[model samples]
Target: MDIKVLGPGCPKCHETERLVKEVVAELSVDASVDKITDLMKIAGYGVFGTPAVVVDGEVKSVGKIPKKEEIKTWIEG
Candidate 1:
C-alpha cells in the first residue's frame, strides 16, 4: 500500500506521520509512507488542510490527528 501524509512539515503533520508509522508497524503491513510538503502536490490531492492522510491514492483524513484504531482500519481496509 502507498500512503502519503500531506502537510507543510508542521507539528500536526509530523504527528500524523508518526501515527502512520506506528500503525504500519503494529499491523505488520507492507506499505510506503511519504510526507508531501509541496503545496502543488498537496493541492493536487484536493486536500486544503494540513495533516491529511492519503491511503492508496484516497484521502482518509484531513485537518486533525486520527486515532490509531482509525488509521489501522485505513491500512487494513
Candidate 2:
C-alpha cells in the first residue's frame, strides 16, 4: 500500500504521519509512507488543508489528524 501524508510540516501534519505509522505498524501492513512537504506537490493533491491523508493514491481525509483506529481501518480496508 502507498500512503502519503501531505502538509507543510505543521503539528497536525506531523501527528497524522506519526499516527499513520503507528497504525501501519500495528496492522503489520507492508506500506510505503511518504511525506509530501513541497507546496507544489501538496497543492496538486487538491488539498488546501494543513494535514491530509492519502491511501493508495486516493485522498482519505484532510485538514485534521485522524484517529488511529480510523486510519487502521482505512489501511486494512
Best candidate, lDDT: 1
Candidate 2, clashing residue pairs? none
lDDT of 1 by residue, 22-73 (tens): 9999888999999999999999989768899999999999999999999998
Q: Residue 48 CA error for candidate 1 (Å)?
A: 2.4
Clashes of each: 0, 0
TM-score for each of the candidates: 0.96, 0.96
Q: What is the alpha-carbon lDDT for the whole of candidate 2?
A: 0.91
Task: For each candidate in turn, give its C-alpha RMSD to the true structure in angstroms.
Answer: 0.6, 0.7
Task: Report every candidate's CA lDDT.
Answer: 0.93, 0.91
- The reply for model 1, stretches above 4 Å from the true place, is none
Residue 9, candidate 2: C-alpha displacement in angstroms = 0.7
lDDT of 2 by residue, 1-77 (tens): 99999989988899999999988888889999999999999899898686999999889998988998889888989
Clash count in backbone of candidate 1: 0
